[model samples]
Target: MSESYDVSYPGVRVWCRDESGSSSLVVWRSQWTPEVIRIETPTIYNRTVWTVGQARVLRDVLDAAVRCAGGGSW
Candidate 1:
């Protein structure tokens, strides 16, 4: 589903998950300065699976995004 940059969704986590040779990652709260610390994944994602923490963050971010887009957060 993500061989390249997915324009379908505009989020950093998703983007980071799909980037190539991206053995490590850092989820920024905002696109601002060097203020946020990054969380390292157990393994690099090749569009295959998600680590427990990664999956959790993904679900939460997607849910919030969906709600903010006007759909209910439930």
Candidate 2:
């Protein structure tokens, strides 16, 4: 199962998922200038950067997750 939350900052979102009883938290942030997505996985202390297009795909996935959870303002 998965859950998502809206961050205080605009264009930022966070989510967590449980798979086989393991949980991971992910954060997505939209950056300025060249335009990139910053992804952070706190469980493993890992970070990755993605292009705007890639970020949009992830955003869409998160949106679907929110919808599956019955929708919310966050």
Highest TM-score model number: 2
Residue 44, candidate 2: Cα error in Å is 3.2
Model 1 poorest ten-residue lDDT run: 2-11
lDDT by residue (44-69, candidate 2, tens digit) is 55677777798789879979998899
User: Tens-digit lDDT track for model 1 on 22-74?
Assistant: 44343333234233323444354423334446657876997798878998623
The true-versus-predicted C-alpha distance at residue 43 of model 2, in Å, is 3.8
TM-score each candidate.
Answer: 0.34, 0.51
Any idea what lDDT model 1 has? 0.45
Could you tell me how far off, in angstroms, the CA of residue 19 lies in candidate 2 after the best superposition?
11
Candidate 2: misplaced stretches above 4 Å? Answer: 1-33
Check candidate 2 and list the clashing pairs. Answer: none
